[model samples]
Target: MNFTRINGLAFAFSAIKYIRYNQDFTKTTATKTTDPRPWLGLDGLVLALVCLLFLILATGDGSGNESDARLVLTTRRRRVQRRLRILSSVPSALIVFLLGLILCFIRDPTIFSDIKLGPSRFHVLKITWDDFKVGFVRGAVPQIPLSVLNSVIAVCKLSGDLFPGTELSATKVSVSVGVMNLVGCWFGAMPVCHGAGGLAGQYRFGGRSGLSVVFLGLGKLVLGLLFGNSFVRILSSFPVGILGVLLLFAGIELAMASRDMNSKEESFVMLVCAAVSLTGSSAALGFGCGIVLYLVLKLREMDFSGFPFFRSKSEPTAEDESLINP
Candidate 1:
């Protein structure tokens, strides 16, 4: 009878323990399954703060100042030699941008119709966890390469030509700025990156100093906050032809930078790369093809003596030998 009583108590305790364990498990599962906030939540804010701290720690000292100083000296020397004002084009480009904006507004009167003036109807962007994940996977991943190519590689190359003293790193710019933009994307911000065209435009408009970017950012922020809703519509009215013209000039400027390539072999490679780029409609494809072509040309020696055209009646002339050697 005592054994039976002890067994009953033991069973009862076991059952109680199981019940409590199950309840705790259920609570944990429920918490795990709860929907995450769509917008920049506490977690996102924490992540952003961590990133900011990392950047501050990583770039604590101005170790790059010596290079920048040398660049300034070189720039001064170039300016003195060339006798050209770097800021000369800024006014014209600014005027063109303003004119383009005005023309767009003039062309469309109903551009502001969609903008509601009341405080009650303000549109708020809803950014969910799903949105952030999808953006990171789909948008940001793909954009990194494109931004590095178009913004850093192309822009830096062009900048080097236009401002011989300037130096920029493609990797550093892409990693830091790209990551920040990706973080911003979680909060419903459009994915942003520096671009060659934008850089060229800024340069053309006399934006040699870092202050230019600061001023521009401030202007854009003020404008956006004041007329956030109508901004899209206003931009939509810009004349495509005018924009095309701007792009054309930027392209020309970039092309002109290629003049610095002194070697015939390098020039040939560049031409082939350009042709491949035009045909493939992708800079990455062209870059790959160029690398392959350059390697093949460098490694494998080709002899034209086997061809009938090379089997001349007489021995090769000095002129022919000079031409061949040259």
Candidate 2:
């Protein structure tokens, strides 16, 4: 499968950062808020247990070789593969989500007290010059490069890798993301962007075509229409352990995409980027570093056989390699 090693690492780091945000150990307590404490906690252990159960369920079919095109399957084998595919199409996340709701209901029914169906809350236009300046500096400035790399570039690249014939352009994705935020912000929605991790997760879960996204959009629309603020209770009460399991699998699946790097230099670049992203908590920094490292490598490999300006035009280049292999 065609993949970018750096993109895979970015997905994994993003997942880890998201998972950490949800875990109890990462919470802001009165005293522990400022301290960098260990990540081990009761919730972490519970999450691990839930993850193990889900992992078993996910791999129970033991059909890892489904992607091995070299193997010619018998009719019976094909039947089994078809059956597994059908079963996999049934979203396991729904089951986990419902289970979490049930558990919450049983443990404390008061959590459902806020489940009154109604319209969603919307924000009135209240932007001031100061707010805009502060938001631009604190939020937009840092997010620009990250969004460009992860949302536009990474997503477009992954879409091509996952769907060979499908060609997604960064410009299209960028425009889509911008339009989405412009409309969504008025409805009090969080700023959103298309992400490589999200694309990888969808593909891992058997969402192969545009129809899958259409169905998902329809489902969300229905839910919003019917429940509105009521759904917030379900989300708030949902089991963190189960959520952790979902994120854990997503991160692993995304990380596995890096396996196709196949070259030491590519792997080295990816690892350096991932490490910096994780440690510095800045995707922009990692991306900048990766670009610099890639350029350095290319410079080292430049043909010095001729004078700098007289290099052979026929020499193989990285772009040519990617085009041939991709």
Model 2 residue runs over 4 Å out of place are 1-51, 59-89, 121-123, 258-262, 303-326
Q: What is the per-residue lDDT of model 2 for residues 212-324, given as tens digits with 9 covering 90 to 100?
A: 88998898889888888788776765655556556655555555654357789987887788777767457677777888998999999987867856766687899989999
| Error of model 2, residue 31, in angstroms | 13
Instruction: Score residue 109 of candidate 2 by CA lDDT.
Output: 83
Report lDDT (CA) for all predictions: 0.54, 0.67
TM-score of each: 0.58, 0.75
Top lDDT prediction, candidate number: 2
Q: Model 1 Cα displacement at 197 (Å)? A: 2.0
User: Model 1, residue 91: what's the lDDT?
Assistant: 54
Off by over 4 Å in 1: 1-90, 116-144, 301-326
lDDT (Cα, tens digit) per residue for candidate 1, span 1-326: 11111222223333323222222223644222233222243223232334324323322221211233445557677665343332232254455556668766677877757665422333457778997699779876766655666766766666665567875776776686768775775455666776665665455445667898899999987777767756777777664434433444444434443345668777777777666665524556666677798889886666767789867678889999999999
Best by TM-score: 2
Ten residues in a row with the worst lDDT in model 1? Answer: 1-10
State the lDDT at 222 in candidate 1. 77
